[model samples]
Target chain A: MNYLFDLNAFLPGVIAGVAGLIALLIDSYKNDHDGIYGLTVVSLIAALGLSIIDMFGPVGEAWSGMITYGGVSAFGNTVVLLGALFCVLISREYLKAIEHEFGEVYAMVLIATSGMLALASANNLIMIFVGLETMSICLYVLAGLIKEHKIGAEAALKYFLLGAFSTGFLLYGMALLYGATGSLSIPEIAQNASSNLLFIAGAGLLLVGFFFKVSAVPFHMWTPDVYQGTPTTLTAYMATASKSATFVALILIVSKMLPAETAEWSEVLEVIAIITMILGNIIALVQDNIKRMLAYSSIAHAGYLLVGLAAGTPEGYSAVLFYLLAYTIMNVGAFGIVAYYERQQGLDFTDVNNYAGLGFKRPIMGVMLSIFLFSLAGIPPLVGFFGKYLVFAAAINADMIALAVIGVLASAASVYYYLRPMVYMYFREPHKDVPFVQAGITFKGTLIVLTILTIYFGVAFGGLHDLLASYYSGDWVTHLTGN
Target chain B: MISIDWYLALSAILFCIGIVGVLIRKNAIVIFMCVELMLNAVNLSLVSFSSHYGNVDGQILVFFSLAIAAAEAVVGLAIIIAIFRNNFSVDITQINLLRW
Candidate 1:
């Protein structure tokens, strides 16, 4: 192991951390909290630029293989930063509307991004736990930022309780794995994978933690309440950026670090994926609240991504990557629209009937949201269709035909609930005579860009897919751990 | 010297107690304490394994877990306090503004 620190390898995380502190410093003096927003966005863009640049550069392990930041990690970092960027852009209107423009929100988000970068780049189980905790702690605070709002505080409390409990599971799993394999480095653990019952139980327990983070079935009870109770902008970040980071960590571990254990675990994951898909979509059908409905749909989407993980192949890895990109774009856009049209700031504007005549009132917002929902439902000519296609295709290619069939049916069932809001928007009469808020340029611009990307990526994602499919120099499987 | 099995078995027992407490305890603060217990149980196992194998890595992990667990407790208590400010109680059942 080298004694020197690889400063360049850790630059992205450094940028976010320093920027978060700087924002907090600026927030202290600026009584009104206006300056911090600009500072936060600038830092996020800078981090995004660094991540993209790193993607094109050379790749290798850093800090004695504690971290690796090239290839998929680079791509994941860029996606997370971009998600943060969009959330920040949409949040300005929300905080202003609610008169809750606390500058600490931006600082907290930057810290969260820093944590995410650490998580995506982790090579050891200990590193993964630390990164996960840092990010989770920040999000617990962000969920209840509106301190006076009971719903926000409750969301924070519930999320904290569930999150801490899961962390306990995660830690115990790590302990068992360490006892069985005698190491915390994932590659070392992989190298020592045996059919011993201890090893299998340790791996199973480890997955229990990741599943909770991804909000898979049997571990997703807190998602709806947290999503509905938290402010919409924060909910957008939690649903998209947070979810993507975990998927990246999960894919890296399951596919790269622990492929030897695939046979034992993939079947188990397949069964779990089937259950998560069926439960998520079926429950969503009855939800009247927009945030809660999207929360359930997000669980189904996690199931689809898990299908790729259960395949345990390089193609499965790439498919999960592409799916996360599509999921981030569409999910963030959907939540952004919800944040945009919310009538009351603290209260969730969730009745299905509230969307009535929305298409006629604001065609741009309605059409944009419709396209996002369509993309989510696996409708073609949208990136979300390709997201589902690549995953189920990978599952089929891996000879899990039963899992593929279940995925298709669950997605088909999902389309019904996805279109319910559109039906109310274009066909029915609104129940409330609510006054309209003027649409601003930034709001329209964010929607138009997301809509364009959804279609553009749908047709043009093959190149990106191939890029993700290409195994890289820094990949733990390819060259690291003295393998 | 105590055998490692004793430590592992004790850790497992304590871990189960923590899980059951979290499931049954209604007060948020007590639930937080249960989470701490679970974490400490893991720490005990980690420390036992580290000593048995003569490996410092497991000991280092125990240290990190201890620190992070403290940080988590801080955040959890803060959130619980925030909720208490609103409703004067931290009973999990009392905080259901956005239930299914």
Candidate 2:
């Protein structure tokens, strides 16, 4: 509980910022591609390394009850940094293709990632809003970075406008909660939970805003359009990093701030989760675009994550963390292939038909994408199934039997659409000769790491479960109750 | 001449109007105005709650929220301008390129 400026608390942002500066400087210089990419990789690696150290090392102290730090905060940041690294790797060919490429995409991502890190560790409501905006504003621009393209500009507009609307709701919700509880610190809010109409309305509005961010049903109209319209690499970043940050924030609210009123929030979340899962998977079945399919699937996966959230236990939170980790790997890997195909075909053939006979045309990339899709569909002995298993079990443990049933049905419904690309690659005949683009060393390195992690988590589930259990062992609630 | 409950009720009605406007209106500028309305509703409640609690934190939050509302207005309008330049219309329905 020492109160000197903990370098560990700020080191990740510093690293990301400094790395971003280096990339920016390189862009201003000789415009050498290798140097820019090389510097970016090095800085990201350094930041990744430092972030990992802070996570496993001693790093947090209670900041006047506004914030506390420990393993859980570090774990979330580590996930975000890993996401940033993969995003940088995937952006190589994606940015190069649209002729609107700039080194600044890397900088924007790193800066936004720093914002995410800040958010994960936020203990104060003000800190939460600041971090949320920081993460979101960068993504808003990144979504439309292709300023010259019609779709890209439109996507950016939609994201920004809707994002602002949701933020308004979120802020108002926070205000009502503050009025009811007379506190803005999460711990203090939990300490003052009331069942008044104002409190209920506030919490309800707050969750509606979060559901929009997580692309849950009824608020998910923005997902497909944004995903399909934005550059593939940025879509992957949004699908992963934005989703992770929001889920972590949701976990904080439910686990720390809403315990006294769990029944109310749980009921609301149950309905949202059921609708999200069904609507997401059912709509995905009809998608012809690979990117759009993944977008809907991402929504479905958000539903699965919500199942864990509704459980209202430490086990549920940990399961969500694990599932998000698994989802990141599979989803980003699928989009990695999309980026690759865009480079090879000189067009983003998100259409399923364009993937016909890609299995033979580019066997390795095709196979990897197939693996990602299968894992996403919850194929057994893959990472995604494990993610589903942990979450569903947590729901059942909490006696949310009906929710667990809905989750299983959605996973089954998901299989048909997820396997469509694989069917195209393996079963259909080639219509034309599509040139295969060579993945640079960086892209290959990322794919290899993600694939390994996906397989490892799928097979070594017990080890991960034990690790997560220990990581989440702290009794924050007891601390709140002064027990 | 109004009771606290009446003021709160008025604020709630104004807030609902704003939320409906945001959800149903497609004109970018009008939607922006609705967002402003929602913020003002919260401000109304915050002021009343401040007097009720006899505390100043709620008022301080009101000031802070006003600042944030201003910031949001600036950013939202800037984005609207960009969208207009690209699409030549403020009708949000034309922004359908990014919707499902």
Candidate 3:
């Protein structure tokens, strides 16, 4: 247990944190939004590049086993950084349109991204708690970015109250786990994993906390409100990046900390996945608000990811990683388009009926939104379809045929809701003459990049899937599980 | 000497009370306090566990949790105040402008 200062292992998070502080200092002194924004984007891109490089580097624990770097953690960091980059890229135009382009927003986003980075690689319960709270507190403020808007205020309050409440459960669970295992480190907990009452109770509470963060069913009441009320671009950030980071942490817990001999936890996950899928899709079917609908859709996507977790195999875990990357790209694109429309009229522009004839009005955005929605619906030749395919394939391979069948059916049901906006955009006549909203070159460029990635990854998902799967195979498995 | 079980039991009871308060309370401030209580309860348990194990990790975790709770309270109160200024009320039941 040599406590070496492994700067390389923590560099991505360090870059973002230092950049956030600099952004904050700049904001306090000068109030320069553009400079702050540029700084944020450059720092995030550098962090993303470093994380990608780390994925191919040697897998090891660092900071005296409080953090793990390379392999899966690096992949998680890359996904989170990618989500943050896209959100920040598109946020400038949207925030300016809303007349609230504060430099502080950029600082908060960077800080939150750094917290997510910490969470992704967190090997200790203390790191997880601190990382999760840092991210949540910033998000609470971001949710209420417009304090004057009643809905925004309401969203922040609800998010804060619920988020804090969940933190209590999470902390208590961590305490119990520490007591049961006599250690706060994840690998140590795994080595001492047991099916005792305290251990099971702690695991259940931890699951509740993760489920709330991920917005799974029953714990999902906060999603629609928070997503709808938050500024659209930051909503995209919250929905994709934060969820990816938490899911990565949950994956670590499920794979490492839980006793493999117990079928109880898997059964519990299967049930939650079933309910999250059915309810999320069914409720989304009737939503008129595009942001709210995407909220429910995100919940449904979480269910599909949970299906992979329930499969309880290395294949299932890697499938989850692949699905997360695919999910991040398509979701940010979907929400990015929503932000585009949202900033145009400011409030009430997000309703699906308002999208009528919008396809013809702005053909490029219309086409890009279509690509993202289709990908989300798991259509062929898009990354989302491959993501769904890999997850269900992993489930089937693990002999969870019932779970796979239910997942396929739920996703098939999801296609209807995902296509609702497209139907209104292309097929229906415009009830009101809404003018086309002009988007900046960078905003359009980001969407275009996302669209190409969606299609390109769909067609060539094999290589990425193999790469992710390799992270969970052979020596990497022993390294990750600390065997 | 009080066994560690006594501390764990007391902590569990306090946590349950806090959860109940959060679930039933309407005033946003009270709910926030209830959350703080829940956190304090966890802190108690962590401290007891640290002493029981004769290691500093659990105590260190308690410190982090305490710092996090204070940060959370600051944000939560600011949010509650912001919502109050808009709606002129801190009652959770009345803050329903974005319902499903």
Q: Sorted by TM-score, highest first, which candidate order results?
A: 3, 1, 2
Clash pairs of candidate 3?
A: none
List native contact recovery per candidate, as a fraction of 1: 0.79, 0.43, 0.94
Clashing pairs in 2: none
lDDT for each residue of candidate 1 in B1-99, tens digit (9 for 90 to 100):
879999999999999999999999999999999999999999999999888888988899888888988888888888889999999998989987877
Q: What is the TM-score of chain A alone in each candidate?
A: 0.95, 0.94, 0.97
Model 1, A20-76: lDDT tens digits are: 988888888875466788888888889999998987766778988888878888988
* lDDT computed for candidate 1: 0.87
Cα displacement (angstroms), candidate 1, residue A162, comes to 0.6
Error of 2 at A5 (Å): 3.5
Candidate 3 lDDT, A93-169, residue by residue in tens: 99999998899899999999999999999999999999999999999999999899898999999999999999999
Question: What TM-score does candidate 3 reach?
Answer: 0.98
Q: Candidate 2 docking category? A: acceptable
Which tens-of-lDDT digit does each residue in A1-483 have in candidate 2?
A: 654555546667667767767777777776766777777777777877876776666645555554445566766777777887798887876688657677777767876887787777777776677678777877877887775667877777788778877887887787788778877788787778878877888888888888989999999988898898778988999999878877877887787788644346887888899999999999999988888889999999999999999987778889998898898888888898888887665444777888888888888888788788889989978899999999999999999999999999989989999888889889999787756657887777788778888888899889767766676565645654552
Q: Residue B89 of candidate 2: its Cα lDDT? A: 90
User: What DockQ does model 3 achieve?
Assistant: 0.92
